[model samples]
Target: MNQIELKSLLADRSPETPAGRIVRTLSERGSMSAAQLARLTGLAKSTVSTALSELKRSNMVVETGSESAGSVGRPATTLTLNPEAGTCIGILIGQSEIQVIVADVSHQILSDATAVIEPDYSPARGVEVVRELIDAAYANQWRSPDALLGVGIAVGGPVSPITGEVMRGGIPNWAGVNLHEMFGPMFDAPIFADNESNCSAIAEMTWGAAQGFEDFVLYTLDLGVGGAIVSGGRVLRGIAGGAGEFGHVVIDPDGPLCRCGNRGCLEVYASFREPLAAAERHVGHALRIADVVRLALDGDETCRRLIRQAGEAGGRGLGLIGSVFNPALVVVSGRLASAGALLMDPLAESFERFSLVKGRDMPDFARTLLRPSAFVDNGACMGAVGLVLRHHGQPLNLPH
Candidate 1:
């Protein structure tokens, strides 16, 4: 019952020990019964019970509640991490937007805020905006910044995992910008950073459609087409943290010039930019991505056609992914995903046509599963929170 010993045991971030696995499991799943923990952690029941006893004695874990099935005579008590122990922050450094989400050790979001910035905002300006957002979030919530345990940032583009520097391709203004250097001065706690698409993947895995799947790909169709790849429960960050950058892949060497300075990158065609612009022209005014999606869902053929085309183009890139990883699941994300069947149906049809593996060629269990994301507006933000919950760090923070 040595509480200090238990804390010390759980404090180690290295994933080598049983205690580390247990701690990570608790962080990922807010609350669970001893049996559930044993099942989730794949640890022996006796081992889990022993660990729980130590954790509870140290005040690191607390008995939150109990669950009872209708036919069950006994209630199963639930245990959760001590909410008073710590807190975490998830920040999204997006294109023309910024978001901040605060949550406690128990993985419960306490407050969320967003700020919209003009395109090509300076790195210094971003730091200032993030600082103000964090301050405001804390001030409004009456939460002490001292309680913050870690911070996870979801950047709009490719990030250098080793140096925490933003790559030039995703966010032009953020080129050579070091994430840790940019935000480290604002907080004493650790920071985690990753690209927005990867963050979105993390969110999907933690709480959305990919919750139970260890391997999946997140294909985003929005103003920009981007994605992340997950293999064996780990995000496959290539040598330069560019492993899952599906959008930047040059599909046509002679095609239109892409923002990434590449010829015929998948993003140029697959991205919703052209369709969104078309929608604006048709509507005779500026329109948000969501606005177009709503119009399509409401039975506007023009809008519907626009989305369907985007889905078709997106599937071409997705098909290439199918040839490469042949992932077991694909989570279609971003604002366009909100269109649901209107988007997915055509997208799936196109995927089946273009992909090397066809549904008819594979059994039900082997066919790639495609699902829409749960959160449309705040997916990256939630993934930012996922970084805290899952301990997946970008360059800003060191991972254990």
Candidate 2:
């Protein structure tokens, strides 16, 4: 395989060539019919056909499978980049866990693994653990990391845009650590990093519920209430990396203190942390967010009531987000989202009650659609892989 040519085309953000556009589009959207590619790339059918022919001839693109063409005609041929072209790594440095995903250019994940770490682990220690995980992943796979194109890091919190540092308020020990500096020497390929929520938004937009949406909001109603905003097919990472911190939004001045060192933050009220504790106390055992959701789904009244209350509380935060962005779609994610309608129904009602743009006032098409995430737990990690595929040409930069 011409790894050099494929790598060059992947890095060429501004394609200027039909083949380049096709490769980039495939990398971002995974497998699709040639007609779908032509529509997505906005190229003439003849132009796409000609470029795809050359790409296939060069062993860059390959036919994956066939899918029926709706209720008419024969099955359309599905196509994707050859899986042997090259690989990309996506690492998630989360609050108390680290995840690694090795994937090929065709969007197939080769390996996925996670390791739990202490909450306040040092950045250097975190790096050591991540390196170990990556090494183990490749040891099991036949593919060589020699053709690695790039690496994407998804941090649990916001990463500074200008300084490239992990900002305060996300990971307690990660604040101020430069992500690019920490991971640059570990790999020869370019490094891309972003907030985990933003990565999740990319995952949703690329392969999950937010697919076909260029604009939407991802409200994560997890242990902590956080979110990400996507505008024009790009995540909006605010100036100081605090753009989508819905959790830290202060709703009251005299309430309890927040982990971000703020008082009366929406997280204090809306996050599932307190409710999870209440459920655990009621059951006399610790319960994961998912476990609580499952219990609720199984008709445990205490768990069900806790989730409903959490959803009602979470909706106020969504209402705040809705008032500001007025997004067309809000993909509710995180572990709590697994509760489905037990969370969404009340959340939607609360959103309509609190948001400035009332759902009753808008037309059916104009009203915002609230949808659950496709992946309850690993959306952000999958998005970490997308970070490399979607934004490989750009390299992280910080002041010297």
Candidate 2 Cα misplacement greater than 4 A, ranges: 397-400
Model 1 Cα lDDT, one tens digit per residue, 1-400: 3434433444455656656677778888777788888998888999988878877877888898898834856888888888777778999888788899999877778889899998888989988998898888888876688777778888877777788878754765887888888888888777778888888898888888898889999998887787899887777767677878788899889999998788999999899998999999999999999999999989989999999998888888898989998889999998999999989998998999999889879999999998999878888888888887776754365552
Model 1 score (lDDT): 0.83
Output the worst ten-in-a-row residue range by lDDT, candidate 2: 391-400
lDDT of 1 at 341: 92
Measured by TM-score, the strongest candidate is 2
lDDT of 2 by residue, 40-104 (tens): 99999999999999999999999999999999999999999999998999998988999999999
The TM-scores of all predictions, comma-separated, are 0.93, 0.96
User: Which pairs clash in model 1?
Assistant: 193-394
Candidate 1 positional error at 370, Å: 0.4
